[model samples]
Target: MTARETPESIVVVLGTRPEIIKFAPVIRECLARDVPFTLVHTGQHYSRELDRVFFEQLDLPAPDVHLDVGSDSHGRQTAAMLEGIEDVLVDVEPDVVLVQGDTNSTLAGALAAAKLNVDVGHVEAGLRSFDREMPEETNRVVVDHVAEYLFTPTEETRLYLEREGVAGQVVVTGNTVVDAVYQYADVAAEKSTVLDDLELSPGEFCLLTAHRAENVDHPDRFRSLLAGVAQFADLTGHEVVYPIHPRAQSRLDEFGVDVPDEIRVIDPLDFLDFLRLESTAALAFTDSGGVQEECCILGTPCVTLRYTTERPETVYVGANCLAGLDPADVVAAGSLMLGKQPDWTIPFGDGRAAERILDALTEVETDTDTAAATVTPTETTATETLQ
Candidate 1:
């Protein structure tokens, strides 16, 4: 195959902390290899506390394009992102678009790029919850089908794609989330003053976070979950440090649910503060997908609040237990797992995910005629049937 000039540009998109953390290594790798690339900020997360702080503290390259498509109804948020992202794709004309994980922004970026016939590469691909009720599950499935390169984080994920007959090379490149945690945890632990500020000793507090779209959308479930956590804290006499998500905060306000005094509702934290909190906590209760991997890697036990998890490797190994949305179950699971010895191990690979992703992207067999050739026969068949 003839080697064309190096790609004019590749676009890396981020709108959340997990995306930033997971994409950090990939971005740095692109720079180290002198690959031409640009960063795009989708503003799905608009707060300085939630979004900008991460980019600043991590010393991530400032995003070349910022689409401040802030908070809105789910459909409105996604639709706004689609229009904004498509415009960026047109202006930049990137050869490939890289999106991470199952977020609204991820799906928007992928759809925008794929619609334009630009090569789309999805990092952290093949994660499945098998529950269509989850918007994230649908987002993951759709993006996988459309992505040109699927950089899966585990062997399970790779198999998941193959079982669905997804075309493209599926590479189990380990998880970049592990890569971020491993690379930053040590420095963060030493540098972060989060424990001191919170006025708590390490291992004395339980870290809790609940910000999934599914959980927050339902008022009854969300209220019960919060009340149960508060009860657990009151009963155990252990402080609960919850770095609140913006969406969750709005929901609490709308529902007029008072955040119990025992459960501390703090502003969203940057990566370092978050890691310091995660590493030092007695245990974590969360609805987040990334924290499951981070807690397991840190040897911290976790009780997931959702009914199902895409990161089942952590659950299968026993690091995490799914407590669903029931308040009683949350309290019981939280109490049981807090002081227990963590037996679960991460089946996600050992921190080389970024390198593997880079390798896969660079090594993909680029058949220029593949899209056209597949379309011609389908079109011919349609015409013949009509005649």
Candidate 2:
């Protein structure tokens, strides 16, 4: 096989805490196997409190390159990341670039690598909310189409790719969040004292998170969501523990929105502490895609704060219900979910997703080597005969 034809190195690019948590196992696998790779951080989630704490808690190595392209309007942020990532890719000359989920960082990484003629592997690809209004939906669609390898998390996602006629090789590797949850949940339980600190008990409180622009940026929507959560807490007599994101907090102040006293808004938590809270919560109210998957995996009933969800498997399996922004709908959904038994089967995976993903990547390398070797000898023989 020609050395040039086979992948020799991989560049893993990510930006947020969720990306770090999901990719931690992949980075560890590369280190353990002595795989030649470089980690690149886009700094989309640039806050030290939000981003740096994840790396520390997850035990990930410092990124080889940091773009430091902090918050901006979506177009500007993505454009900045695209420029920065292309520079890094040119310098690294990696054989393949890997990105996870549907963030601006993920789309930028895929777009840069494709433009540079490098193979791009997209983890958590083929998800579709079909709502173009959501920036994440747009990012996932664009990245999936450009990626050379689509590592889907489920059969449904694989089918989504097939129906879309994606040119990439699609593989069902299960969700890496399953791996993260299984790996870190116990650690969180052992290390986190958030329950005691908050004066809450497990299975008695609701965990709430709303950071998406659609949910928190609009003053009316934000107020309605908070009011609904407050109502739910009052009705259930359960505390709603909300770990506020920096942007969300700023928007609240900028818009003159007030948090209901019933909803306890705390500072954002470390990954471990968040995981502990997620696993033990009686119910979860969220707009984040990752939280939906986490709730399903942890058997925690969830009321999705969005009108549409990409993870429909959660709803089909009776784990999540869509409540949108209507306060009455949110409370009703929460009430219904609260009474439901936690007996739904988890559709994500058995938590060996990281191992499977690494194996799939290695297999691609091997297959490329075999195909290159076969083609080289035949071409060489034909040239000799002609000569």
| Each prediction's whole-model lDDT (CA) | 0.81, 0.85
1-387 per-residue lDDT for model 1 (tens digits):
222345668998778778988899898888877888989888888874556678776767888888888888779999999998999999999999999999999999999999999988899899999999998899999999999888777767878998999976666677787778768887797889999998989888989999987887678888888888888889888899999988899989898888888889998888899999988888899999899988877878889998999999878777788888788998888877878665444566666677766655664444433321221121221112212
Assess every candidate by TM-score.
0.90, 0.92
Error of 1 at 222 (Å): 1.3
Location of the lowest summed lDDT over 10 successive residues in candidate 1? 378-387
| Highest TM-score against the true fold, candidate | 2
Q: List model 2 lDDT by residue over 299-323, tens digit each.
A: 7899999999999988988989999
Q: What clash pairs does model 1 have?
A: none
Which parts of model 2 have CA positions greater than 4 angstroms off?
A: 1-6, 364-387
**What would you estimate as the lDDT of candidate 1?**
0.81
